[model samples]
Target: MAIELKPTEALKLWHDVNLDLVRDGETDLTTRQMTILLTIYLDPPPHTVRGLAKKLAVTKPVITRALDTMGKAGLVTRRRDEADRRNVIIQRTVQGSLYLDRLSDLIIARAHALRP
Candidate 1:
């Protein structure tokens, strides 16, 4: 017997689930920022702003802004691409890696708690 839920109900459920983490300060990242950060962190070092924009399906400006914010937050470092001096490459800092590790741990713990 499958159950159907209204769109609002589903959204509420998702909001509640997400809000719990925010309320507890488990994650400070906005959805878009987190997506961009994880996308770059998951891959090899030296991710370009353009490449990150493409990967995240967002505009280059969006990626640029996110990178700037992340940079200010000490979560990432941007360097001029050696091969292409005109382009910039983004890399995760030690702090960034630690943040990612913490996020993964929190998510895994939450998932485990939900299991029987």
Candidate 2:
């Protein structure tokens, strides 16, 4: 027999995953920062604040604020593009990658363990 989750329950499960991520270590990622990180990882190349805002359907100022937080957290680095000085590109640092990797592993393992 299998359990059928209600739509509300399913939504809660989605929220739970993100909440668990927030509880990791002594720090938590703001939703915007997490979104930025995910977007960069999914895209073929890193993006500038303007590009990220467009991709996220947000205003450039919002993306800039999120980037500022992420930068302070050491999750990303911003640099001027060599080919275009006006472009500020964002890249995940090794620490950020490792944090994401561990979070993924823990979530996967927990899900597998939950399967009866």
Which candidate's lDDT is highest? 1
Question: Which pairs clash in model 1?
Answer: none
Residue 21, model 2: lDDT of: 67
Candidate 1 residue lDDT tens string, 6-96: 6866666566557666886746777889888898788876688888888878899998888888888899898997888989988878999
Candidate 2 per-residue lDDT, tens place, 1-116, comes to 99676686666656666667667555577777788887877677758988898888889999888878878888888988999998998887887887788767766665544434
Question: Global lDDT for candidate 1?
Answer: 0.78
Give candidate 1's TM-score.
0.78
- Model 1: residues >4 Å from true position, as ranges? 1-17
lDDT of each: 0.78, 0.77
Using TM-score as the measure, the top candidate is 2
